[model samples]
Target: MKKRVVITGIGAVTPLGNTMETTWNNVVKGNSGIAPLTRIDSENFQVKVAGEVKNFNPADYIDSKEARRMARFTHFAIAASKMAMNDAGLKVGDNLDGERTGVWIGSGIGGLDEFEEQHKRFLAKGPKRVSPFTIPMFIPDMASGRVSIELGAKGMNNCSVTACASGANSIGDAFRVVQNGITDVMIAGGTEASITEMTIAGFTNMTALSTNPDPTKASRPFDKNRDGFVIAEGAGIMILEELEHARSRGARIYGEIVGYGATGDAYHITTPAPNGEGGQRAMKLALQDANITTQQVDYINAHGTSTYYNDLYETQAIKKVFGDHAYRLAVSSTKSMTGHMLGAAGAVEAIFAILAIKEGMIPPTINYSTADEELDLNYIPNSCKETSVEVAMSNSLGFGGHNATLVFRKFN
Candidate 1:
């Protein structure tokens, strides 16, 4: 028999807030995290706005010297991982088996800030001018490696680098490792910090980012006037444990991870497959994995990036998978509030999914004024709603045609 997997704790470093509680509160209130880009000189950039983590003081999470050695993304990942472990009621010196705990994390473009700075130094001075920490800061796997070293977790350490699908893929892979008896407890999720000159210029050139000046109206996913995703930076981490292990240790159970599905489009580099064939397959696979019917899923946190192609194709995928149930499901893109966290998007949205199951409330898709005729779904526009969600599905589609879906069930 397959071992049961359950989520025991959650943490987040998001644009709206640093902790999960604060972020969820703001999300339910339909608050916007998007704002004018202040970190960089945006005068020349076409996309002048973004969803930035406001007032984040790295000192609060790491030592001054240690903080300087790592990339900002690693700082976020370590901070979030610490919070998650504490939330799960696990102490550093506890009797838990060190070999039973592992770390699995993801990031789309890791340490972009470090790369840009070092490259500038190299050009101005010489190759030797680059910092010794450059290699550790730039690799995507360093996120998980740093977390494991910080916490002394040694069971299984891995990182998934599936573009925007990185987080969900990481979390799902961690769940599988524990479920398959490789580990009893796992620290799983994703983080990203790619808001840099090159990323912005490239995305702007590709016209993949929103140029809307007004922060609140910039990332209006599924809306008729939806333009494009607003680049954001953050991390979301969660604690996953075998059901029996958690229950035996008296751990606080948040929810159960019931299903996970991953696929590739094999169609396009950036755009989703026409009619969302990959997305539909992922959703169907998740439903089958969970042994649940379409109607059983009460909510769907869409990968609605506010891009025209993404929103439309996601809607098409939902219609194809859920059929009549699509109209009845409460689908919302919290990206409307947090913008897009790239690699961390899926993990953060999964946190929302668990919260919806626990609180019996569905977060709204803010700035949803006019609906598109081709895309019609109950998006819970502009306000939160109270409803019991037995099961929830969160989808993430990436630039490399990667499609990932995760299903969470309310813990009884």
Candidate 2:
């Protein structure tokens, strides 16, 4: 028999707030984290808004000297991992066996800020002037490496970089590790700090980012007037432990990770497969893996990126998977407020799904006004909803046609 896996702790540094509790509170109130882009000079760029993490002080979580050596995304990951470890009440080499603990963090684009800076320095000053730590700080897998070192987790340490699905895939991969009895505890999530000038310019040139000047109304997923996603930055980490291991330590359980499904579209580098065929398969596979019927799913945390193609195709995918039941299911995109966190999006949204199960409240898709004719579903728009969600699923569709789904059920 496969071992059951449960989420014992969660930590986040998001545009909504720097911590999980504060972020959840703001989300429940339908707060918008989008604001004027201050991370880069907006005057030179067409995109003017972003969901930037505010009031984040890395020194609060990492030593000043050590923090300086890592990239911003790594800082967010390390901080969130520490917070999750504290929340889980499992200390490596103390309450938990260090050899049985692991870390699997993902980032779609790791340390782009550092890469750009070093590239500039190399161009202006020469390669000899580049920082020696650039390689370690700029790679996508460094977040997991740093977390494992900091936490002293000696088990599996890995990362998944499937664009936006990176975080959800990391969690799903870690869940399987525990479920298969390979590890007792795993720290898994996603992080990204790619809000640099190059990233903004690149996304803007592709017209993948919203050009709306007003931050409050920029990210309106499923709305007819929605333009595109607002690029954002942050990290979200969760502690997943084997069920019996958690119960033995008297750890508080948040939700059970029952199923995970991942598939590749094998069709596009950026756009999703026509009608979301890949996503449909992912959701169906997740349901089959969970051993549940379509009617059993009460809520869906959508991968609504506010893009023209994503929202339409995702709606189609949900309809394809759930059929008539899709209309009855409550679906909302927390990205409507948090903006698109790139690699960190899936993991952060997964936390929202878990929270909905624990708190019995669904976060709203803010800025949703005019409805799109093609997309008709209960988006729980512009306002929070009080509902009892027993089984919730989070969908993450990434570039390169990666589709990942994770199903969470109320831990009975």
lDDT of each: 0.93, 0.96
Give candidate 2's whole-model lDDT: 0.96
Sliding window of 10 residues with minimal summed lDDT for model 2: 89-98
Q: Which 10-residue span in candidate 1 carries the lowest summed lDDT?
A: 90-99
| Per-residue lDDT over 101-160 for candidate 2, one digit per residue giving the tens place of the 0 to 100 score | 999999999999999999999999999999999999999999999999999999999999
lDDT by residue (tens digit), candidate 1, 324-381: 9899999999999999999999999999999999999999999999989998899999
RMSD of each: 0.8, 0.6
Q: Whole-model lDDT, candidate 1? A: 0.93
Candidate 1 clashing pairs, residues 3+ apart or interchain: none
Query: In angstroms, how far off is 391's CA in candidate 2?
Result: 0.2
- Once model 2 is optimally superposed onto the true structure by TM-score, how far is the C-alpha of residue 353 displaced, in angstroms? 0.1
* Model 1 Cα shift for residue 169 (angstroms): 0.3
